[model samples]
Target chain A: MMTIKEIRKRLDGGDISCRELTEAFLDAAKRDNPALNAYIRITEEEALRAADAADARRAKGEALSPLDGVPFILKDNINTKGITTTCASKMLANYVPIFDAFIWEKLRDSGAIMLGKGNMDEFAMGSTGETSYFGATSNPHNLDHVAGGSSSGPAAAVAGGLAVFGIGSDTGGSVRIPASFCGLVGLKPTYGAISRRGVIAYGSSLDQIGPIAVCAEDAALVFDAMCEKDPGDMTSVGSEPVTPKLTGSVAGKKIGMAREFFEVMSPPVREAIERAVKLFEKMGATIVPLEFPMLRYTLSTYYIIACAEAASNLGRFDGLRYGYRAESAADLDDFICRTRTEGFGKEVRRRILLGTYVLSAGYYDAYYNKAQLLRRAIKNEFSEMFKKCDLLLGPTVATTALQKGSGLTPVEMYQTDICTSSVNLAGLPAMSVPCGFDEKGLPIGLQLVGPHFGESEILSAALAFERETAGEFLKSSGMGVKL
Target chain B: MISLDELKKLANLAKLSLEGEDVDALAADITSILEFANTVSEAVVDLPKDEAAGAYNLREDVVAPSYPAEEILLNAAEKLDTYFVARKIGGTGA
Candidate 1:
């Protein structure tokens, strides 16, 4: 149950060797992963070797990054050399990357031990972990409920204490939503803050790799490690670090809570938001009511844009090219039909069709173009609102995690993403901090979004709130049970 | 009006193949999705023509390190020493 920082201290102090800690995490992962379904692969053999090297370095009195010797899991979508970065799709299930993702190299250079690959929705399309080809990731808090996805396995792994923290790509709350449901701190940094090189792209414009961890403080640490100018990804900001420059106080921060968001949330979720707002007010922050009427259409716009991008990005997965191909075929079309039929899951197929339809000739202006127009409107609405407030606040999801097989239709399932997608569309930084639990004992996350490149302020406010509340999700009883 | 054949065509463009029933299902699904999409015209006003009208521009052509031909071809399912081999679904006279 040791926090990441505490584990680091023990490693630095020689009270416990790095090898011992890695072994401990590996053991925990072996035991927990079965119940949680958090991992798609575990690198126990490699982790042990890395831990031994780290210990040797520390014994020589060499200085290392704070993350040294810490075991962390990565979402399967991010490439790791020699490891299969399947992106939870059967087509690429055995596709081991020959080169490491840029961030992977950075973390490796920092002396972090690789735990394994966490599961994710196929191509990061679904909001619920249910879309993963590997099988759904169960919420650690409630086994009968889903871990919010496509970062489901990452969040569940972190919450289950199978790994210190996990890296997940957030496109439309893929990271934050799971973090909220699993009661972890999920930070979707401002666009381009982290490099996307070697990470499988879902939506080239919207996908961002972020951290899901036990607390906001730990997320900041991970962010600092991965925050660098990666020449590999042109979109990466050049050698700029903003967290260290964050000096503002949340005490006097003017926070805006969207009335529109409140109208959509469940009663318990609304109450939790109210309670969190009051707590922030007590912590010297002021809450203001704001209107963002265009958010009602965020899901529509997000689906069109994200699916369109996905359709294009995933086109490279033809069987004869680089993915799993049928053993025998009558012809090339037969090969494609059989391979795709067996390779892709239901949700991936659904989205691919949806995306193709939107981007098809003649229909593009009606669907994709219209969605972009609405995206601009949503962005403009938030831009104007940001003029009056330092940050915007709302429940991360409209309701608590739904029960498994609750039979939510396509639209109902899409609605779960409503509260989180607007920030992604606006290209702003946001974090989901644990607020409270529902009567069913599931976690609720209160998301704080700031203007573009405002992660430092967002983190500062979230960290301050977490400190004031002194409530850690893992501290609650029944938290680590099957979800 | 969209039809199942058109849905199948869209799927083929996306490199996906659907059964006739799936095509029908997807066509129905897309029809509803497009119906909701039709509402966007009413939802947004004063759409910026310039913003919606532009696409990302690439930088000037420049030489940069690239994967060796062998390495690039290594990821292909079928590869020759100098090229990747795939069944020619459609390419010019193929």
Candidate 2:
């Protein structure tokens, strides 16, 4: 698989036409998608058309952005104009958006070719890709193992060389988890750093669209292109360009490690993270040991708040608007009831019910309100920790990719999100960079978390690690386009 | 544990109808999830005085041209010229 820089160099040198490059990717998708199930829909026509436009622009010597002519996949949750934006659910299976999502508009304006919509967990509700109505995305590394959710397809597609990079939304570990499992780089930018105008909301406060790429540098380029304030999404604060600041130097930097983050981690994951800490130390980074007791409460607080917001955000899926409508019903109320009951998957329904319970009159104070208060406590802890450390380092997940049909219960699945959810709760920037592999040869992700709007700092650190390691841990699945 | 009757009421509030075995399974799931969420109650922290105050800057209310009705209603299951076609109140047809 070629990096964006390699593709750009070839395009500039006239070694390859943009159309040919896009075709290569499209061909790869055709060959590999049957086994990987990476894409829910492949926009072959759109991709070729965009490739021609890119070639024409190059022919005319028009100014080009780094991502111009770059083919990438968008997670199914982000809307693309006139394209179906199913959140990997039956509810919106046939629903096409009339307008583009803000991030999609940004990418399209940059001349990024849309290959297709990547599969994901239904309504971005599950940690594993198995919950997707389209079906689970298989791990590119080992086909028997599952690709981590809910941005499973995006990560798989990128790892399988289906696209240069993929755009994914991370409410919890959706982006980073899969990237970790697939040996790729995934960034969940600070909340509100990117616009969410046309992103189908899961947890409005927690959800932020991010990049899944081969390396931190590629992730930085995509982030720079798509991060911008938009009137449509009032929460968007945009972001400063991080690519320019990626010095690949970690000298004199203080990296903090909280002891609590390791309690749930398996032995191999712990050793991998510890080795990464030693490598950073050798690169002149100071390791600061810290205790973050608040980690215990992040999972519960995150699930409560996320599900509560999800229940409210997903209320618009009634039969009257768009999406799947029941074939038969006795009355208006029955129509909506039947549609939702039939449309949503099991995991989505469970979350909606849980959210309904928390926000119900009597339980509001006990669950929703308590979670909010704990959210503040968690945020305050992050703020205090940032004062003493340049960045916090931890495991992206407690374990590697589980085999398909692991059949973990719902609560057990939610527990896997413990390492990644706190970043969203505090609206902090964080990323997963591949550090090493477990004994079973699955990738392990080392998480670099930064203060609010700290994308540059964390990205710089990631680039440094990538450079120092010479991408030794960034293994390829050897399945898709090898150009 | 959440009672089956309570789960039914919650499902009703969510506008979702659970039938037979699904009701039992969902009840167990929700109960376990709620139990997991109950861990938050044990957290001791200093509550902010302004808990309800949000920091977002509100955009000024401005009237703008809306999307074309046809385009907006493109994905609707059933639509008239400019409005969605839904079953009438107490109507029999789906």
Question: Which candidate achieves the best TM-score against the true structure?
Answer: 2
Model 2 misplaced regions, further than 4 Å:
B52-54
lDDT of 1 by residue, B22-63 (tens): 565566666776666566667746866548422333455789
For candidate 1, what is the DockQ?
A: 0.41
| lDDT (10s digit) by residue, model 1, range A32-80 | 7887888999999989999998999998977478788988989999988
What TM-score against the true fold does each predicted structure earn? 0.94, 0.98
Q: Candidate 2 lDDT (Cα, whole model)?
A: 0.91
Provide DockQ values for all models, in the order shown: 0.41, 0.77
Model 2 steric clash total: 0
**For each candidate, what is chain B's TM-score?**
0.64, 0.84
Q: Scored by CA lDDT, what does every candidate get?
A: 0.82, 0.91
Per-residue CA lDDT of model 2 for A1-483, tens digit only, reads: 678998898988899999999999999999999999999999999999999999999999883799999999999999888888899999999988898998898899999999999999999988778899999999999999998999999999999999999999999989999999999999999988899999999999899999999988899999999888887887878888888888888899999999899888999999999999999999999999888899999999999999999899988888898999988888988888888999999899889998999999999999988899999888889988988899999999999999998989999999879999999999999999999999988999999999988898999899989888997998988899977
